[model samples]
Target: MDDVARLLKESWTLVEEHRDRLSGHFYARLFLLDPALRQLFPAEMTGQGDRILDAIVTAIQVVDDPESFEEYLRALGRDHRKYHVDAEHYATMGVALLDALRCTAGDGWNLTYDQAWRDAYGAISEKMLAGAAADGNPPFWHAEVLTHERYGQDTAVLTVRALQHPLPWRAGQYVSVEVPRHLPRVWRTYSVANAPNDDNVLEFHVRTPPGAGWVSGALVRRTKAGDLLRVAAPMGSMTVDRASERDILCVAGGVGLAPVKAMVEELTTWNRSRWVHVFYGARRAGDLYGLAGLRELMETHPWLSVTPACSEEPDFDGEHGDVSEVVARYGPWTNHDCYVSGSARMVRSTLRALAEDGVPPPHTRYDTFGDL
Candidate 1:
C-alpha cells in the first residue's frame, strides 16, 4: 500500500487501545483550539466521542480505494454541513485530529507518521470542502412533524413536512435527525420510509431499541405534531440501481424495514417486468409495524411479493424464523440483487446466508453505515 494507508493502519492499531479517550481528547483539543465549535456539538458528549473515532476508522478502511474513499468523504462532508460546518473549521478539526493521533501514537510517532497524517487529513479536508461546495445545497432542512402515529409501545411512523425547501433524495437513502426538545444537537440517522412525494412530506419508521432509548424514545414517544426537527442531508449507497435489470430480494429486520419500504415504493413505479420479493422480520409480532403498507404495495404492484417473518411469537404467524434464515430458505439468489438492513447482527447474518445461497458480493448492497 500507500504510505498513508500503511501509516494509518499502524496509527489506528495504537489508537484503538486509547479508544475511550480518542474522541474526548480530540474534542477537548478542538474546543481549546477553537472554542466556537463547542456550541455546534451536543451538550452531552456521551455518544459523540465514539462517533468521531468511528468516522476516522471508517475513513482509514477505504483510503486505499480511491473511488470508495472519495464518495464516502464527500458524503461525510456534505453531512457535516448540517452542523453548520464551515471551510475554516476543517483546518482546526484536522489539527485537533492529528493531535489525538500524536497522543495515541505517543513514542511510536515519527516524522514519517506525521507527514502521512498531514497528507491524509489534507486529502480528506479537500474532498469534504469540494463536496460542501459542489452543490449549492442548503446546510440542513427544517421540518415540522405533521404526524407521529405509534403502532405499538415502541414503534412510531412520523410524517414530516419540509418548509420552503425540497430535500431531494433517492429511495433507500437515510437522513440524520436532531430533536431540539429532547436533546439538542444529538442526532441519529433514520431511513426515509417512502418514495418522494409532491407534498414535501417524508415518512420515517422508528423503533426504540435497547440502549437507544434516549433518541428513539424521543422520536417515537415524545415527538408530537408541529414539533420542529432538523434533518441532515440524505446519504446512502444502498439505493436502487435502476439500470440493474436483475430481480430483487429485499431482507429487512426490525426498523431496517424503513429503507426497504422506500425501495419497494420506488419499485412499484418502475417498469413492472422486474420482480421483487421482500422478507421483513422482527423479534415480536407487535414490532412488525408496516405490514399494512407492505400489503397495499403488493396489491398495487403485480411484480412485488411481501413476506413478513418473525423470530418470536409463533402462535399465528405467516413465516416463523429469523429473517436471514427465512431468506435463505427462499434463496438461490445468485441472479438477483440482494439488499439487507437491520441490526448489525441481523445484517451480518443475512449477508452470510445470501453468500451461502450463492449471491455475489457485487450483487449485495447495503449502506456503509448499515450496522449503525
Candidate 2:
C-alpha cells in the first residue's frame, strides 16, 4: 500500500465511529469559513448530511489507489460543475474537511496525518479541476420539462428539452437532475431512458421508493409540464461495448432498466450480428410499468429480446419469480457481455448470480451511484 493510503486508512479507523459528528462538524465549519457557500447546498440538510459522510468514505476508499480513481475523480469534478463548484471551493472544502478530521480523530491526529491528507486532497482537487477544464461543456444546462407522465402507483416518465444548448451523451449513461421545487441545489442521479434525438430532448424513468426523498417525490407526484430543471453532463460507464462482437446480456431491477433500455436502442442502430437479451424484474405486475416500451423495442429490433418477470406477483402472465432465476435458466453465458444495474444491493446479488452461471468477471459491467 502507498504511504498516503496507509495514513488515510489509519486516520479513518480512528474517526469512523464518529462519522455522524464528523459530518456535522464539517458543514458547521464550512459555513463558518465562508458563509456565502451556503447558497450552493440544499436548503434542508437532512438527507444531505448522510451524503456528506458517504462521499468522504467513498473518497478515502478511492484514494487508496490513486491511479485507479483518476477517472472517477475526473467524472466527479465534471459533475460538480452543476453545483457551481470552482477551484477555490475545492481548497476551502479541503480545509474544512481536514479540520473535521482533526477534531474527530482527537489525540490520534498528528502532523503526519495532516500532511498525508493534504497531499491526497491536493491530488484529488488537481485531477477534478483538469476534468472540469477538459470539456468546454457548460456547468449546467437549462431544461424545461416537456412532459411528465405518471403511470402505475409511484412511477413516472419524464421528457425534457435543453434550452438552446446541446447535451450530448452516450447510451446507458445517467445524469444528475436538480429540481428547484423540492430541494434547491440538491441533485439526484437518474438514468437517461432514450437515445439522443435531434430535438435535444432527454427522457428519464423515475420511480418513487416507499418513503422517497424530497427530489424523487417531487418528480413523481409534483413535477409537471413547464417546470424547469438543471441537468448535469451525463456520467456512468454502463455503456454498450460496441467493439465486441460477443452476445450481450443485460439484467436490470425495477427502475434500473432505464440505462438498459438506452443500450438496447443503441444496439438497434448498428446492423451487427451480435444478439442482445434483456431481463427486467420488479416486485409486482403493476411494478412492471415499462413492459410495453420494452415490448415495442423488441418488435422493432429482431436482434433484441426482452423477458419481463415479477417475483411477488403471482397473478402476472409473464415469467414468475426472481429475474436472476429467469436469467440463470438461459445460462451458462460464458461468452456474453453482461451489464447489470440497480441499487447497490440488487447489483451485488445479480453479479454473484452471473458469476455462478459461468460469466467471467471481466465480461460483466455495472454502474454504481458514483456522483463524485
Candidate 3:
C-alpha cells in the first residue's frame, strides 16, 4: 500500500500541471467508453474536472492509512449515490481514468504506476460501493426553500425544509445541493448552519463573491421562498465529540461560520461545564454577518463567548488583525479541543498557530471552504 501510494504521488506530479487537459481527456474517454454515463453529469462541464481530481489527490494521499482511506472512500461513495451511480459505473470510470492517466503521463508513466493505480482504484471502488449499499436513506432529498435573507450584495442566509423525509445529519456536516431552477445537475456543497431539528428545517449561509460560485450566486441572488432543491447526503467529520470534556476553541472566517455555528448550537443544548470560545472574523465589521447571532447566543449561554475580529477595517471596534492572530494571542490552546473553518489560507494559518501552541493533531478539527 505504501509503495502504491508513493507511485501514485510521484506519477501525479508528471500530469498535475496539465490538469485541465487531463480532465478533458478523462471526460472525453469516459463518454467514449459509455456514452450513456454522460447524462449523469451537468450539461456544462465548467469546474467539474477539478472536483474529481481533488478527490483523486485526497485518495492517493491517504492510501497508506487504511482507516482514513476507507472512511473517505466510503463517504465519497455514498456522496456519489446522488448521481445514481452504480458498480458498473465505477468500473467504467476506472478504465477511463487509467487511460487518461497513461496518456497524460506519457513517458513518465510506467507499469508500476499502472498497477498501483489499478490496485488503489479497486479498493476505492469496493469501499465506495459498500458505503452506498449500506446506506438506507434516499440518494437525495427534495427540499423547499422556506426563507431567504440576503446580507449586503454577495451573502445570503437561507432556510430550507426537507420535504417528505427527514434528512439526518450531524451538526458540522455539509450536504450537496442542486438548485434545478437555476443550474440543473450542477451541485454545490454547503455546511448546515444550524443543528438538526425535528422540524426538518436546515439553514445555510452562502457567500457568492462577485463572479464566482454559480450555485451560491443563484441561491443568494436568484433563489427565493418556494423554490425546490435537491439535497444530497451529508458528509464531514468536524462534529463535536460528546465524550470529550475539553474546553472548546472555534475559529471561523467569513461564511465558514456555518459549521462552527451549527456545532456551537449543538453544544448549547447539552453543555454545562465546558467553556466554548468562538473567534469570528471577516475583512470588515460589516462582513461579520453572523456576529450578531453569536453575540446573542453568548448572552443567553453563560459558558459561551464570542470575539469578533476585523482584518482590514482599522477603525472597527473589537479585535483588529487576522482572526488567526487573535486566536494566537488568546491561546495556549493545548488543552482545548479546537475547530477551525474558513478559506484554505485562513484555516492553514490558524492550524499553524494551534500547532505552535502545542495542540496535538487529534485535538483539532478543521474544514476548508475553498474546496467547496
Measured by lDDT, the strongest candidate is: 3
RMSD of each: 1.8, 2.6, 1.2
Q: Give candidate 1's whole-model lDDT.
A: 0.86
Cα distance off (Å), candidate 2, residue 245: 2.1
Please give each candidate's TM-score: 0.95, 0.92, 0.98
Clashing pairs in 1: none
Cα TM-score of candidate 1: 0.95
Instruction: Report the poorest 10 consecutive residues by lDDT, candidate 3.
Output: 208-217
Ranking by TM-score: 3, 1, 2
Residue 208, candidate 2: Cα error in Å is 1.4
lDDT of each: 0.86, 0.84, 0.93
lDDT, model 1, position 355? 87
lDDT of 3 by residue, 218-306 (tens): 99999999999999999988999999999999999999999999999998899999999999999989999999899989999999999
Q: Candidate 1: where are CA atoms >4 Å away?
A: 368-372
lDDT of 3 at 226: 96
Q: For model 1, what is the alpha-carbon lDDT of residue 152?
A: 71
